[model samples]
Target: MFQKILIANRGEIALRILRAAKELGIATVAVHSTADAEAMHVKLADESVCIGPPAARDSYLNIPALLTACEITGADAIHPGYGFLSENARFADILAEHKIAFIGPKADHIRIMGDKIEAKRTAKALGIPCVPGSEGGITDDEEALQVAEKIGYPVLVKAASGGGGRGMKVARTKADLSDALAMARTEAKAAFGDDAVYLEKYLEKPRHIEIQVLGDGKGNAIHLGERDCSIQRRHQKLWEEGPSPALDDRQREDIGEIVAAAMRKLGYIGVGTVEFLYENGQFFFIEMNTRIQVEHPVTEMITGIDLVNEQIKIAAGLPLTIQQSDVRLSGHAIECRVNAENPENFRPSPGRISYYHPPGGLGVRVDSAVYQGYLIPPNYDSLVGKLVVHGRTRSEALMRLRRALDEFVIDGIETTLPLFRVLVRNADMQNGDYDIHWLEHFLADGGMSAQ
Candidate 1:
């Protein structure tokens, strides 16, 4: 086991990694910027180091500063909790060159999966079904048109280098194909420094589903199940649930087995998510996330498996302790991301929190770093907290989430709580009949009659 691990991120995920390491009797070093000196993770860590200023570019994303922190702390491993440098293949390679283990997949795997175009090819080669589209990057307008026509209308022009819904443009008809291709290329170059873009047949009513898997990098692996991340806005997932209402036990089991077999064949290590777009009972694989996802809490709730801990163990050269037969999904779980934003306009709202109270009870877990009097700096992502709930059934979980949301209080700042309160009462959300576009359409149609 690693004696000391340095967490190279911030917010709830940093705190999450710290706790998991501590539970395993491993010391943790929390690296933070000046704005996060008073952050909960820093205070709770065995030691702390100020990496840089408030700007993420100079702080959290600063590679040299993080390596220096690890050197000073004599940490043996780095756990990049989800975002920031988590998926940076160069960063992982550098750490490995310095004899420091990265608590994730190998640098080679990260490099392969980091590129959206290559990831699709790799997944398809592994026998995973993919959305019909281009064979590779489209170099010009002619290629783009050919791909669009072959794939039929309603194609998505997307960046080959990065994701997070950026560098993407959709065209529903042949007339719009050229504009989408140009726009996507421009955005891809500006956002990811890569002008490479590809085309794909876009599903109109696809559900965003992802399978969670853990591996030892030595041919052993297992799948935890699937998460329904269909409730999203502008491609950002707001709410997530485990044991997707869209799939029955047979479908879930079959998909889980396929994912596990693929991971085992590829020798994929640590924790990773295989995301997909589902429509009409058919799943078309999307690009896989090379690191832990933001919605991992819901998976943990149902499987009772500590994914972070498993990642650490795998990085420490340990084999998976549980097998596919040992795995079992017990209940339903849901997670609502509480962001510091206006409920109506969804504008960032970063300011001092006058009052705060997180709901507490059985089957409820709140992951956050905010507290009363804490000032939320506008230098980072707007996510301030995550409220996760679990129950024996989906109905019970939904009710628990509603009650928890009512109890959660963060005064002096706008949050998405109001929007969630309204969403929970919607018929589509209640019956789990929503797709990726459902949230946007609901918002357009007046979210809640009272909102």
Candidate 2:
């Protein structure tokens, strides 16, 4: 077992990892920037180290500073709690070279899955279903046109190494293809420093589904369940739920087994998510997140598995503690990502939180690091917290989420709480009748005003 672990990120996820490490009797070292000196994770850790200045480049993303902190703290492992440097393959390799364990998958796996193009190829090679698209990156404009025509109209031009919808553009007609390709390539180059782009046949309406998988880096692996993250705005998921209304029991098991078998075959380790676009009773592989996902709590709520705990154990060279049959999805779970932003414009709103109150009850859980009087720094993500709820059924979970949203309060700053309060009451949301683009369309059509 690792005697000590250093957390390499901040906010709610860092706090989440700290609690899990404490439960396993492991001492934790929290690294923070000058801006986060008063952060909750720093205060709660066994020891804290100021990495650098406020800027992420000089602080959270400083690899050498992180290494120095580890050396000084005598920490044997580093747990990157999503975002930041979590999926940086070079960081993992450097840690391994220093004989410090990274509480995630192998460097090679991270590299393979980090690139959207390579991830698609790997998924197809593993017998996982994939969307029809170009075999690889399209460098020539003529080749891009040819691929677009072959895939038919309404093809999506995507960056080979992009995410969060940064370098993606939709071409609805032949005239749109050239512009879409140019825009996507420019965005791809600016966002990821790579101009490589690919093509895919865009489905008119699809739900975003991802399978939660855990592996021991041996030939052992298991899939907890699937999460339906269809509710989104500008490709950012706001609401997530488990036991999707779109899938039946047989379909769920089939996808879960396929992902688990693929992980076992690859000798994967730690936690990973295989994301897909589901439409017309089929799932098309899109990408793989090699680190814990922002919506992982939804899966944890349904499976009753502490994923962080399991991830730590796996990093400590532990074997599979539970079998596939042992894994069970007990109930329906829902998660609402509460961000510090205007409900109407979706702009960043950061300031001192005058008064704060989180929802509570038997089936409700709020993951947040903010408190009354806490100054939310504008230098980082605008996410204030996550409100998660679980119940015996999807309808009951929806009811619980509605009640919880009503109780959630954060004063002295704008938040998306109002947006959620309205969403929970929407008939489409309540009935699970939504796709990835549903929220955007709803907002455009004055759904919030209607509520």
Candidate 3:
């Protein structure tokens, strides 16, 4: 194990990593922007350093400042808790050059999976199912049109280096192809500094399923099962659950084993998610997240594993602790991303939290860093917390989620709590009869207003 670890991000995830490291008897150094001087993680860490100003580019994403923090703190490892520099391959390489361990996958693996086009090719080479479309990035307008026609109507033009729904456009007809391509390229360049885009056959209704795998970079890996993230808005997942309602035990085992085998072949390290678009009883590989996911709590709840602890251990050259056969899904788990935003318009709501009360009870857990009177900085992501619940069955979990959401209270600002309250009672959500587009359609039909 590392003597000391520096948390390279802020918010709940940073606190999550800090707690994990503490459990492993490791000292923690929290690096934060000026705006986060009084953040919970900073206060809890053994040492805290102000890296830079409020802007992410000058703070969390500032590699040089982070390296200086590590050097000054004598920290041997850094745990990037998702987002920011978590998936930056160059950052991993830089840390390696400095002999500092990065608690994540190898730089090569991150590079391969970070690019959407290369990820698809690599997934196909590993025998993972994939959607049919352009074999590589399409630059010419004529080539883009050809690929779209071959893939049929309603093709999705996506950024080769994109996530979070950016640089993605849907062309429902031949006449829409050029405009969609241009729009996606422009957005991709702005968001990722790479305009390269690819095409994929769009599935009207598919569940967003991801397999969580952990590896030791020694050809040893295990899959913790899958999470159904179909309840999304603008490609951002809001509600996530384990043991997908659309899949059975057999299907789950089959996919889990396949993904584990792929990780072993690639010699992947730490925690990674193999995301797929599941439709018509088929799983199409979409992309791989090279770091911990926001919805990882759902998987941990079902498997009784600490993914962050495992990630740290793996980075420290520890051998794989659990076997595939040892992993089991004990119960249904659900996670609601409680963002500091307007439930109806989805606009950000950041300000002083006059009062805060997180729900608690058996089978309920809230991962958050905010508190009463904490001033939520408007410079970062709108997410303020996550409400996770587990139960013997999906229905039981749903009921528990309902009670927990009702108990959650955050005053002096708006939140998506109202949205979740309405969603919990909707017939479609209650019966698990929803797809990737379900939330968008629900909102389009004035579902929130009706509620």
Point to the candidate with the largest lDDT.
Answer: 3
How many residue pairs clash per model? 0, 0, 0
Residue-wise lDDT of candidate 3 within 1-451, one digit each (tens)?
7999999999999999999999999999999999999899999999999999999999999999999999999999999999999999999999999999999999999999999999999999998889998999997989988888787989999999969999999999999989999999999999999999999999999999999999998889999999999999999999999989999888998998899999999999999999999998999999999999999999999999999999999999999989988998999999999999999999999999999999999999999999998999999999999999999999999999999999999999999999999999989988999999999999999999997
Cα shift from native, residue 326, model 3 (Å): 0.5
Residue 439 lDDT in model 1?
89
Cα lDDT of candidate 3 equals 0.95
Off by over 4 Å in 2: none
lDDT of 1: 0.92
Model 2, 350: alpha-carbon shift in Å? 0.3
lDDT, candidates in the order shown? 0.92, 0.94, 0.95
Q: Which stretches of candidate 3 lie over 4 Å from their true place?
A: none
* Residue 300 CA displacement from its true place in model 1, Å: 0.5
Q: What is the C-alpha lDDT profile of model 2 across 100-200, one tens digit per residue?
A: 99999999999999888898999988989999999999878789888887878789999999599988999999888889999999999999899899999
- Encode model 1's per-residue lDDT on 1-451: one tens digit a residue: 9999999999999999999999999999999999999998998999999999999999999999999999999999999988799999999999989999999999989998888889999998888889999999998888888888788989998899988788889999989988898888889899899989888999999999999999998889899999999999989999999999999998898888888898998999999999999999888888888788889999999999999989999999999988998889999999999999998779999999999999999999998988899889999999999999999999999999889999999999999999988887778888999999998888887775556
